[model samples]
Target chain A: MTIDKKLNGTSLVIALEGRLDTMTSPQLEEELKTSLEGITDLTFDFEKLEYISSAGLRVLLYAQKVMNKQGSMKVIHASEPVLDVFDVTGFVDILTIE
Target chain B: MMTLTVKAHISNLSMVQDALGEWLDSIGCPMKTSLQLQMAVEELFVNVASYAYGEEEGDLTLSYEYEEELSLVRITFRDQGMPFNPAECLEQEEESTRLHVEDRGVGGLGILMVYKTADQVHYSYRDGWNILILEKKL
Candidate 1:
């Protein structure tokens, strides 16, 4: 998957494209590591994200945990397949989605 | 005999997800089937890492073999972290207040998804490992 990052004041928006499987999860994690600092609000645009693996969910969970400390996090426009993955994993309750 | 093994750190989950799909694709499984298999892998691995290992570190071995006649991908997950098989546990239904959200969806969904996706699944604790085997016809 490809990830692009944008900053809106303290809010950080990340747009994801392609698939988030085991191989591409690291790129996302790296992006989060490099970009999350100094950003208090985070929004993930998953409209272009086609597929999600449990590993991807785990990363999301981790990002949520991090955001809990510094700022707020949200996921927007998740694709059907990726949404299904989150639904099955009970992330709907844990995450803030729009 | 063929074997592929990789040592993974539990803290990096997203990378593992990407690796799973690429692995299936490399084995010549169609994209659709690969997606299903990868989903199952994701659920099981995350469950193990989260529930079984907790905050500890352990080894995870993912092995697969293709049975051309059956057109199948037989994959197994072996880990020494804990003795638990999520498939054997019954799922908790969603509950609602008037009938609430809890009764709609709660626990056991992941294992159920794994069951639905795999053509065959089995679980056993043998040789100091929690082993889960799943087969998907390609």
Candidate 2:
């Protein structure tokens, strides 16, 4: 997946494209790990993301846990497939999505 | 109905998903059903690829079938690497939900999605093959 990062004040926006699965989740994890410093609001733009698998969800879960300690996180513009995955896994209850 | 055998590796995930996705699409599977199937397929296949062989490579056979009478789609995954039952793991994950979010690890969520999304799930070991059968209503 292609991850585009944009920093604005204390909010950070990361836009993702392509598929997020086992092969690509580590990339996102590293990206979030290094970029989350001093940020209080994290937003994920999934408008271009094709789909997400459980591995991808795992990364998000970890990111959420990390963000929980420092700030807040939200996912926006998720594709239908991604949203369905979130729904099936009950991530809708755990993660803030728009 | 179709059966496909591929190397049990993470890199082959999209290839399997694409093949199954096309077939499901051709059969006019609903978007919701197809998405759920895709999720379960990835989780189960990834599990096999990651843990079944224990640092060795193996082959996994996936058989896809649709029962018109029941309007159900079934996918059976078979591998000879190890006799692992995902249903048992799912049971453990169900009970682990009591743990706090901070204490929760991300490992078992995949199998949990398999159990949540698949309408019927069965695990069996026969002929040295670990077979997992997952079905969803169309």
Candidate 3:
């Protein structure tokens, strides 16, 4: 997956393209780890993201936890399959989706 | 029925998905069903690769069959790594989903999803091989 970042001051928006599975999630996790410092607003754009596995969800959860303490995080343009996963795993209640 | 065997490594996930996706497509499986099956396969395959052999190298064989009459697909994973039964993880599936974010652990959610999404899942260890079978109705 390709992660495109748009940082405007403290707000950061990440747009993802392609599948986010076991092999790819670590890339996103590492990106978030380095990019989240001092950022108060984080948004994920999933319009181009095709697939997400549990590994992907774990990364989202980690980001959410960090944002919960520092600021806020939300997901946008999530596909139906991704939404279904969130609903089934109960992440729908934890993460803000738009 | 078709079978493919590859090294149990994280990098091989895409290869597995591509091969299986092709098969599913050739069989005229619905897009949603194909996606779910692929997700389940990734979870099981990653579980085996991450924990099954620890630092040692191993291989996994994936076999799949499509029952045209019933519109069902069955996928199986066989490995010689340590014995682990994914089917039994269903017991913790519900509790894991209900836990709050602060209290929620990340490890077991993958297996929980496999159980929840797959129509049927079975596990067995025999002849020094761990066998996991997942069935989904298309």
Choose the strongest candidate by lDDT. 3
Task: State interface RMSD in Å for all models.
Answer: 6.3, 2.3, 1.0
How do the residues A52-92 of candidate 3 rate in per-residue lDDT, one tens digit apiece?
89999999989999999999999999999889899989999
* Each model's backbone clash number: 23, 0, 0
TM-score on alpha carbons, each prediction: 0.60, 0.90, 0.95
State fnat for each of the candidate structures. 0.24, 0.49, 0.73
As a TM-score, model 2 comes out at 0.90
* Candidates arranged by lDDT, highest first: 3, 2, 1
Best by TM-score: 3
lDDT of model number 1: 0.73
Q: Quality of candidate 2's docking, in CAPRI categories?
A: medium
**On residues B13-79, what C-alpha lDDT tens digit does candidate 3 reach at each position?**
8999999999999999988888888999999998998999999999999999999899989999999
Per-residue lDDT over B15-101 for candidate 1, one digit per residue giving the tens place of the 0 to 100 score: 565667676777787866777777787777767766777677777887878888888888888888779866556343122112223
DockQ of each: 0.18, 0.54, 0.76
Which residue ranges in model 1 land beyond 4 Å of their true spot?
A1-16, A20-47, A53-98, B6-8, B12-19, B93-108
Better DockQ candidate (1, 2): 2
The RMSD of every model to the true structure, in order and in angstroms, is 6.2, 2.0, 1.4
| Consecutive 10-residue window with the lowest summed lDDT within model 1 chain A | A81-90
How high is the CA lDDT of each candidate model? 0.73, 0.87, 0.91
TM-score of each model's chain B: 0.79, 0.95, 0.95
Tell me, by DockQ, which candidate is best.
Answer: 3
